[model samples]
Target: MIDQLLDRPITDFIPQREPMVMIDKIITCEGNTITTSFLVKSDNQFLSGNRFSESGMLENIAQTAAAKVGYECLKNNEPVPLGFIGSINKVGVVDYALVEQVITTEVIIQREVLNVTIIKGTCMLGDKDLATCEMKIILDLG
Candidate 1:
């Protein structure tokens, strides 16, 4: 419901667990572009559990893209369509972001063929960009 969008961020919506929740809030979403934010806390399970390393910043960018799609479908419409991540490729992490830093990630849809959505994303902490990647996400309802 639209109610969920205001009270809590997308990361807390649905059932994505602690470490897997990769987004904070939707910054800008219109047409085929969406921006979101995330803060990596020292208490994050990934940082604390050793499952995620500093070099995994690209993955965070990809996940932020996922969060954007979910938010777009959830808050902008009635039925709340569901989408899934198909692939993420050509990733590079710039090595500036560290653990417990807030990042602003943006996703722009570059290609959309059929139901597949291909997007380019960048993760930035304030004005500093730390990672970039192109992700192919499979969004289908079936």
Candidate 2:
């Protein structure tokens, strides 16, 4: 089942639609960590002068985390909950990804309490780090 889910479109595991979907595919979701890949397209909204913006990197991270939750929910035959970014901390932008470059993001679940989940996300371009941050996501259970 997990292997089948990996072959499905990223949209099935995330709430964002076209143009707003930051991730292209889910590489893996194991234990408390999830990894995703995104290609920096020329027409991407988060592009800034042929480079992916910091905001884009951040969104990619958040979406990676969302994919994790969504995948789990689907596997368990449960509805995927809507979630929002509660806060972001310790953000570091090492460099921006150029257009056509593939950005890989990895998000690890740091903690989860009730409806709130804390995750640490890191974006990488091959061997170089692009951006990283810790984010708090609040799920709407009601």
TM-scores of the candidates are 0.75, 0.97
Query: Which digits, one per residue and each the tens of the lDDT, describe model 1 over residues 4-56?
Result: 46446565432355666667777666677777777777666546353334444
Off by over 4 Å in 1: 1-8, 11-15, 48-56
- Model 1, residue 61: C-alpha shift (Å): 2.4
* TM accuracy, model 2: 0.97
Candidate 2, run of 10 with poorest lDDT:
1-10
lDDT for 125 in candidate 1 is: 77
lDDT of 2 by residue, 6-115 (tens): 88888888898997999999898999999999999999999899999999999999999999999998888888888999999999998999999999999999999999
C-alpha lDDT of residue 82 in model 1: 52
> What's the lDDT for residue 52 in model 1?
33
Q: What does each candidate score in C-alpha RMSD? A: 3.9, 1.1
- Report the C-alpha displacement of residue 56, candidate 1, in angstroms: 4.6
